[model samples]
Target: MIGETLSEDVLSQLKTILPKYGLEDTELKIIQSYRDSSQLNQQSGFSFQNEAGSKIQEEKIHLLENELRILKDKDHLAQSVAKEINVLFPSVDSFSLGDFLVQNVQDFSSSKEVTVLVKWKHQVGSVERKRLELF
Candidate 1:
């Protein structure tokens, strides 16, 4: 039972759950170790879908989903900022706002005063940093 493999159904359920938890390939190996040690496949009527119905798991899933939504919102904001920068700095040939990495962000007492330190590579293989202000 210990060395036995999980059925396709269980494996499929695991694949769905693992990604929702942000588990990567390395973490999957740890899960495999636990699965092998626990011999979950040998248990009668053991279902990951059923286990996922637990309150704690549901709460964790909800939290992770919220985090993902926030991250997506931030990414959209970044893209919008990039587009705006591209329009504003049209004179800089070969300059892509998306290529700029955010080094630092500072906010002043006034909402209009926002400063961002961005770093990007120049066409001549040099890194350049610029402090941009938003008013």
Candidate 2:
């Protein structure tokens, strides 16, 4: 959830999304202003029914539109990323690397086992063997 303070990157992304969705810079500014105003109103316990508050409320609608647009873009991006990962390592029924590796009987009985053991030793160093008396 976008808390009281949104990041600069999020605002910049909004700027890019606004134009793509036919929104102007001024429109985005107005939307951001409303967001700020609403935060202030929440703190003050005031009804957003005054003239200025009405404008802010209207801008809130635009902000929701912008949020929805961004979410849709993100959803599409997630799908595309999934497809790319699938294509890169196809022939696996599922996406999990751990599950796939464990299920597949790719020969790891000799050289692969040695390679893994060496890599693990390199990672842990001699300290584990010395401490655990794993001679």
Candidate 3:
């Protein structure tokens, strides 16, 4: 049956005899593989449903991964900006990031450009200074 050719007679005989070969007699020795195949078919149906469910969930995972990457990139940019400011004013004692804002505007190139505006605050001694940085 596997890669080997079968004669029509063998095929017909197999179809005819397979079901009747093991009748439940006084001895309970019946073909177990036949019942196993039936159970496997039922289980395959259940797994098919799960497979379809996983397809939808896979898209959800993709979207969440993209959102996570964008957040990480934004955070990295913010950290770099803060580090630069810290280097410029080493005496600055405290730094707090307040809000992140995005805007669309035209630059010197006369094309639409996306601008990321970060609102932050730093304290020197008791004086707190707030500023907005853009990139």
Residue-wise lDDT of candidate 3 within 1-135, one digit each (tens)?
Answer: 113455567666666665587642423322323244456446444333467799899999999999899778868876886788677655554455434344446553343344443333443333333332221
Error of 2 at 78 (Å): 1.0
The TM-scores of all predictions, comma-separated, are 0.36, 0.30, 0.38
The sequence of per-residue lDDT tens digits that candidate 2 reaches over residues 12-130 is 88777886776765555412334575785676666547898788989999999998997677667656755764564333233221111233357644321111111121344456535
Best by lDDT: 3
| Clash totals for all candidate models | 0, 0, 0
Output the lDDT of residue 95, model 3.
53
> Using alpha carbons, what is the TM-score of model 2?
0.30
Error (Å) of candidate 3 at residue 32 is: 15
Q: Which pairs clash in model 1?
A: none
Off by over 4 Å in 2: 1-50, 91-135
**Alpha carbon RMSD to native, model 1:** 17.4
Q: List, residue by residue over 5-113, the lDDT tens digit for candidate 1.
A: 5777877777778867777453433133343423654444345556546877889999999989976776787778777766765433332222233344464322322
Off by over 4 Å in 3: 1-52, 98-135
> Which candidate number would show the highest TM-score if scored against the true structure?
3
- Candidates ranked by TM-score, best first? 3, 1, 2
lDDT against the true structure, each candidate: 0.52, 0.52, 0.53
Model 1 TM-score on a 0 to 1 scale:
0.36
